[model samples]
Target: MKDVQKVLDWVVAEVGVPGIVAEVKDGGRSWFGTAGVADLETGAPRQQGECLHTGSSGKAFTAATILALEAEGRLSLDDTVEQWLPGALNVNGYDGNTITIRHLLSNTSGLFSTGLAPEVAQRYATRAGFRRHRFDAYTLQDMLKLAVSQPPVGAPGERFTYANGGFHLAGAIIEAVTGNSYADEVETRVIQPLGLADTYVRPAADISYPDPHPKAYSKMFFKDGTDLATLTAENWESLLEDPGLAPMDVTEVNSSGAWSAGNIISTTSDMIRLVDALAAGTLLPPAQHRHMWTTVSTEGGYWMPHARYGLGLFEFDKQATGGTPLRGVAGSLWGSWFFAIGTADGRHTMAVHTNTEWKSWDVLFKLIHAAFGLTIGA
Candidate 1:
C-alpha cells in the first residue's frame, strides 16, 4: 500500500498533475490512495474515493446497456442503424444501412468525432470560450447533427477510429428501441443490477460535479495542431507550468457534447465495480457476452498501441501491462482523465484518475506497473 502511495505522490510532486486518486482491488482486499490537492486554490486534499468526470469511460456502460438489451431480444448487434433511427446517419457519406451497433461499439463505424469540430472544440477546448458557454445545454439531436456535418472518416467497418459520435448515435438507438432516455436505460440495466451506487450520468445542463467531488481543470489545448501523444513526463512539468498553458478550473461546464459518450461521473470504487461486471460477464448471457469480447483491430498510431477494441472495452496488449493482458477503459474530457484496468478474471483491478486534462500515456504506463506489481499477489 505504501509503495502505491509513493507513486501517487510522485505523480503530483513530479508530474505536475494537480491531484490524483486511485483504487486497486486484489483478491479479497482493496486499497485506496490519493495525492495532491483536489481544489488547487484551497489546497484541499483529494478524497481517497471521490467522484470525477469520467469522460468516454461511459461508453462501456452505454455499450453494455445495448448488449443487455440485445440479450433480452429487444435488439441485435447486427441491427442496422437505419432500422432503429432512420435517416439519422444517411447524411454526409454515412449510410445507416451499412453501419451496425457493433461498428459503433467497436469504433469501426468510421464516423467523424464531433468533439474535433472547430465550433464544438471552441466551446470546451479554449479557455475564453469555455468561460463564455460552459453551461449551454446540447440535446442528443444537436450531437448527431454535429456528426453528419463533417465528412465520414472511412466506410463502416473499414478500420478503427475513436469516434464519440458513434456512441452518441448508439445512445440515440437505445432511446429509439426502448422509448427511454439512454441514462435511464443504462441505469436500469447496468447500474441498478450491479449496484454501482456511485456511478450516474450527468444531465446536459448539470455542470457541477456532485458533492464530495474533485474540482476539474484543463489547459485548453483546442488548436488544430495540438498533439500530446508523443509527450513524456519530462515535458509536462514545464508545459503545464507555462503561463499561456496554466490549467484553468472548468468544473462548471455542461457536458452535453460528450453525453452518452463521456458525461458519466463516478468514483474509483464504483468504476471498478462497473468494469468488473463487464469483464466478468455478469450483465449478459454467454452468447451475448462472447459478442462483447469479439474485437476489431485499431489502426497503428491511431489509438492505443496494440490494443484491440472490443464492444465498449479495450483489451490492451501485454506490452502495455508489463505481462498480463488488461481489459478496461481510459477516458479523458475537458478537465479530467480516468482509467480502469483489470485481468480477464476480474480478480485484480485498478481504477485511477487525475483532475487535470494534462495526460501522458507514458506516465500512466509507469503508474500501472507500480500499482499492480507490488499489490496484486502480496
Candidate 2:
C-alpha cells in the first residue's frame, strides 16, 4: 500500500498530475484513495466520488446499449447501417447502405476521422460563438449531421480506422431503432438499472462539479513551438465543438461532440460497477459479451499482443507496467486519465482516474506496475 501511495505522490509532485482517485477491488471488496489537488488554483485536494469524463471509454457503454437492444430483438448486429437510419450515411465513393452495425461497432465502417473533414471545421466555427453557454442543450442530431457529411476512407469492413464518426453513427442507430434519444436510452437501460446514481450521460444543469470533482488543465503548443498553460475552462467550448481536438471543457465535450463515443462521466466506484457488470453478464449476455471482446486484425495483419478492441472496451493482455497479465479499457481527454482492469472472470478489478492531462498515462503505467509489486522502470 505504501508503494502504491508513493507512485501516486510521484504523479502529483513530479509528473504534474493535478489529482487522482484510485480504487482496487478483489472479489468485489475494495480500497480507494486520492492525491493532489482537484482545483489547482484553489489548492482544493482531490477526493473520491467526483465524476471524470471517460472519453472513448463510453464506447463500451454504447456497445452495451446496442447489445441490450439486440437482446430485446429490436435490431440485429448483421443489420446494415442504412436499414435503420435510411439515407443518414453519405460517404463519397462508398455505398453506405451496405455497412453493417457490426462494421460500425468494430470500427470497420470506412468512415474517416471527423477531425480531418472540411465541413466539420465550418460547423464548429459556427458554434464557437456560444462558448459561454452550457453544453447539455446540444442535440444528438448535431453530431449525426456532422458524421453524414464526411467521405468514406475505404469500403465497408475493409480496415480498422478509429473514427469518432462510427460511434456517432451508432448513436444515431440507437435513436432510430428505439425512438428515444441516445442519452435517455443509455440512462434508462444502463445507468439507472445498474444503480449508478453518480454516473450520467450528461452534466448537471448548472455545469456544477459533482462531489469529489477534479479541475482540468492543458498545455497548448503553438505552431512556432511556443507553449502556454491555459485554464481548461476558457477553451472547453471550442474543444467540445471539435471532436478532433482535445477537450478542455469536460462537460461540453461529453455532452456535445464526444456523445456516444466518449461522453460518459463517472467515478472510480461507478466505473468498477460497470466493468464488473459487463464481465458478469449483467448488461450483456455471455455470448454478446464475448463478442464485445473480439479484436479486429489490423490492415497490416499484425495485432499487438497488449491491446485489442472489445465491443466498446479495450482488452489489454498486460498492464502497461508489465505486471499481472490483465484486460482493461483506458480513456483520456485533455485533463483526465481513466482506467479499469481485471481478469476475464471479474475476480479482481482496479480503476483509477486522474485530473491532470498529458501525464496520466505515464502515471497509470507506474501505478499498475506498483500494484503488482513490481519495481518502477525495472
Off by over 4 Å in 2: 115-138, 203-206, 220-254, 297-305, 318-325, 358-360, 373-378
lDDT of 1 by residue, 1-378 (tens): 787788888888887789899899988999888898889889999886587888888999888999999988999999999999999999878899999999988888878755556566556544566688888898878888887887888888887878888899999999999999988998999889989898888887787876798888887454433343433323324433344566788888778778878788888988888788788777788888889888877744166665788988988765545557678888887778898988778888899999886466655666666766622211
TM-scores vs. true structure, each candidate: 0.91, 0.80
Q: Give the number of the best model, judged by TM-score.
A: 1
Tens digit per residue, CA lDDT, model 2, 218-282: 43212221121231223433333233344343423324567788778888888888887876666
In model 1, state the lDDT of residue 347. 84
Model 1 TM-score on a 0 to 1 scale: 0.91
Task: Superpose all Cα atoms of candidate 2 onto the true structure and report the RMSD in Å to 1 decimal.
Answer: 6.1
RMSD of each: 4.2, 6.1
